[model samples]
Target: MAILATGQPNLEAGQSQSLHYDDFPPLNSCSKLKIGTPRLPIVPSLPNERECKIGLLRNRHVLIGLELQEDFINVMAKNIYYLLAKDGYLYTMKPLIYDAKFKVEEETTLTMAWISFPDLKPTFFVKESIFSLATAVGKPIHLDMATINKTRPSCARVKFQVDLLANFPKFMEMETVNEDTKETKIERVKIHYDRLPRYCLHCKVQGHAEEECRSIHPELHQYVARD
Candidate 1:
C-alpha cells in the first residue's frame, strides 16, 4: 500500500503521519539495525485531554493522529524516531517534511554534512565559540576530533544538521583580534562544505540538482524531437 496524493501534495512537521503497523518482530528479522522485539506489549490509550493519537496500518507499522487536518504536530517528527520510546524501544516513524510543499517520498532538505571553515581564527576553535558561529548557519552536531584538539590547523571542520532548502552563505562574518593592533575586527571567513549531496532547488528536494530535475525540465525525458 502506498500513500498517494492529488491536486497538491503536502507533508509538514506539524502534521500527523500514518505508518504500516506490525507487532514488533524479532531482532533477527532486522539484522541491518539489530533492533525491535517480539513482545507486543499493551499500549495504554492516550489521555482524553492530551492530543496525538495513534493507529495501526496493515499490522505492519503504527501511525500517529492528531486534531488538525494536516495531522498537527508540536514537535519534530525525527526526534520522535529517537526520543519517543515504549519499553526502551524507539518508535519507528517516517521522516516528516522539514519545509512546506513537499512529500516524505522526496525527503526534506534537512541533511547532515561536514562544513569546513577555512583559515578560521584558531582562538574560536573552542566548542562554545564554534557552536556560536555554527548556529548562524544550522545546528552543530560535533567538531572534528582534530578541530577539538586543534591538531589540524589548516581548517576547522564541524558536522552540522543544515536545511538545504535555504541559501548557504559562502562567507560567515566573525569577530577576531588583529596582531598588528589589539582591536576587534569582523572578518569574512570562508565556509566550505567538505561534501554535499545533490539538492534540487526547483523541486525543493535533497538528492538531485535543479538542472537535473525531471519535474522542472520534462523535455529531458523526450528522446525523439518533434517538428
Candidate 2:
C-alpha cells in the first residue's frame, strides 16, 4: 500500500489519510508503507486563469488549461503531424527519418579524408594544408599526413572535431590550381568517418549502446515500435 502526505493538520505524521479500502490489511503490508511528499493545491480547469496548474493527463492527452485566444492548438496539431510524418507514419510517401531530438550532440573526434586524384603530391597532404580543409566544417584540432607510402600521397588524414547534429557528409570537394594554366580544379574527396564503438539512443551517449542503457525510458519502446 502507498501512503501519500496531505497538508491537513489533523492527520498524523507519516500516516496515510486515504479513504479506507477493502483490500487494505489491518496492519501495514510487510510492516512498511510508502510515503510521498506534501500534496499541492488543485489545478485550475478554465482558460484565462492566472494561477498555475499542475499538468493532468487524460487518455494520453495532456490538459494544462492554458489560455490561447488564437488558433494555436490547430497549428500545433499540424506541426506535430508533420513531425510524425517524417517518421513515415500517417504519410508513407517519404522515407523514414529520425527526429532531430534523438541526435547525438557531443563533440566527436573524426578522421576526414583529403584527397587529390590523378596526382599524389606530398605537398598537397601537409598539416597546414589539411587544416584549412577541416576548418570548413569543424575545428581543425590536429592533422596526420604521414600514412602514405607512394611517391605522391593523394590521401591525407585530418583529425576533425565536430558535433554530429545529423549524418555527416560522405564526400567533400576541394579546389586545386593547375601549375601551367593556374586555373582552379575541383577534386571530389571521400570522407572516412569513424563510427562510435557503442551509441545509446535512449541516453544519447557513447560507449554504451541502447540495449545496455541503464536509464531507459518507457516511451522509448513506443518510438522503437513506430520505427
Candidate 3:
C-alpha cells in the first residue's frame, strides 16, 4: 500500500518519482526532531476611550489631545528638551522657522579650574565675600579644596551649577586692605576656567582625572571645557 506525497519525492539515486507518505520516517521515529511555534509579526491593537488621541502634525509637530492645565503645560515646556510654550501653545524647537528664534537655554554644572592672579590662598575663593562674587556668575554648588594637587596648592577649583542668564566675567574685583594706610583698595584678578589637564589620578587614566575613579561614579556631574 503506497500513496504519493504532494511535493516530497524519493531521495534514492535514479528515482525521480514522488514517494509515498508512509515511506518517509514517522515524526516519532526521529528522536532529534523538535516542533517550534511559527513566527508571526507583532501588530499593535487599536486604542480605546481610555487612550487620548496623540499625533504628529506636519510630520514633526505634535498634536496633543485632551484638555491640559496651564501649570502642567508650562512645566512640560521648560523641562522637555527642544520645546517651548508661548500663549498657551506647545511647540517644538526644531525647524527654526516654526517660531521666533532664541538661544535654547539650559543649566550647566561643572567643576571649573579657578586661579586668581598672584594665586591668592585657597581660602580666598571660599570666603563669604568671594563666594558672593562667584555667585554673581554662577551658583557655587561645591568647593573642592582637597582635590588641589599638593604641588599646585594655589590652583584649587570649585564646582558650580550656573544658570544660563548668569554672567561669567573675565575678571573679578577683590577688595583688599592697604597695610600702611589701613584703607580699602579694590584690585581686579583675571579669571581662568578649566585650564587643568584631564588626567585621572586614581585610575592613572587620561581624559578624566578626579579625586576618585570616574568609572565608579560615572554619573557624577561634569563640566564643559568651553562653556
Candidate 4:
C-alpha cells in the first residue's frame, strides 16, 4: 500500500483509487507492478518499465493502487524510495499504511538504503548480530548474499530502514569482553550508506536538501538566522 508522489508533476488532487483482488498469479502478488506507467512526455529520458523485485520500484504523476507481497508489507509501511530518473528526480515513493490516516502531503522520515559495517567481528556478521547492530541506525530488512555466506569478510551490508530526519552517527561502539579474562574493550563499527536520499531539513521533506529549499522558505531562513 503506497501513494505515488512526484516532483516533476505532482500527483493530481482529489484523484480516487480503487482496490481489487484477482484470483490469479498466486495470492498476495504485487499488483501495481503491472499498471502501465502513464507516459510522461516531459521526462523523456525515463526508461521503459520492467519487472522489478527490488525496492527501487518507481512511479509518478498518477495515484496507483497496489497489493504487495507479505514480505514487502511491513518494509513499505513507513518508507520513501527517493530516486533520480535519468534527466531529473522523481521525488518520492511514500507508502500509505498509517499515512492514510493523515493528510497524504505529510512526508515520512524513514527511507530504505543499504548500509555497510566495516571490520565487524566474524561472530557479528550473522543475521541476528548484524540486525542487532543495525538497530543503532534503523530496522534491518535483508542481508546481501555476500554477507549471508561470509563471502565478504571485510564488511556486512544490509538493506535498512533509516530515519532521514535523525542525525546519523558515523560509528557504533560495541563492548567486547574476553571469555576467560573478562577484560572488555570497546570496538567501533563504521557506518557507510550505499546511497543517501536527499532530504530537506528545512521543509522536513525527502525531495531536496535545505540549501535548495531556501527559496521556498526565505522568510523562515531569515528569521532563524536572526536568532
Per-prediction backbone clash count: 11, 1, 2, 0
lDDT tens string, model 3, 37-144? 112221111122333333333323333333322222222222122222233333332211011222223111222334332344444433343344445455443344
Query: Candidate 4 at residue 34, lDDT?
Result: 22
Model 3 stretches astray by more than 4 angstroms:
1-118, 122-129, 147-151, 177-182, 195-227
Give the per-residue lDDT of model 2 (tens digit) for 6-25.
31111111111223223211
Model 2: what TM-score? 0.35
Q: What is the model-wide C-alpha lDDT for candidate 3?
A: 0.34
In angstroms, the error of model 4 at 201 is 4.3
TM-score per model over all chains: 0.50, 0.35, 0.30, 0.54
Extract clashing residue pairs from model 2.
120-152
RMSD of every candidate to native, in Å, equals 16.2, 28.6, 34.6, 15.3
Whole-model Cα lDDT per candidate? 0.51, 0.34, 0.34, 0.52
Ranking by lDDT: 4, 1, 2, 3
The weakest ten consecutive residues by lDDT in model 1 span 25-34
Better of 1 and 3 by TM-score: 1
Ranking of models by TM-score: 4, 1, 2, 3
| lDDT string, candidate 4, 1-227, tens digits | 21122311111111122223342221111112122333332221112242223222243322322334333434343343333344453444444322232223444555667889886867667766676667677767678889999998998998876777765666766655565675667566677887667787666656688767876757656543563
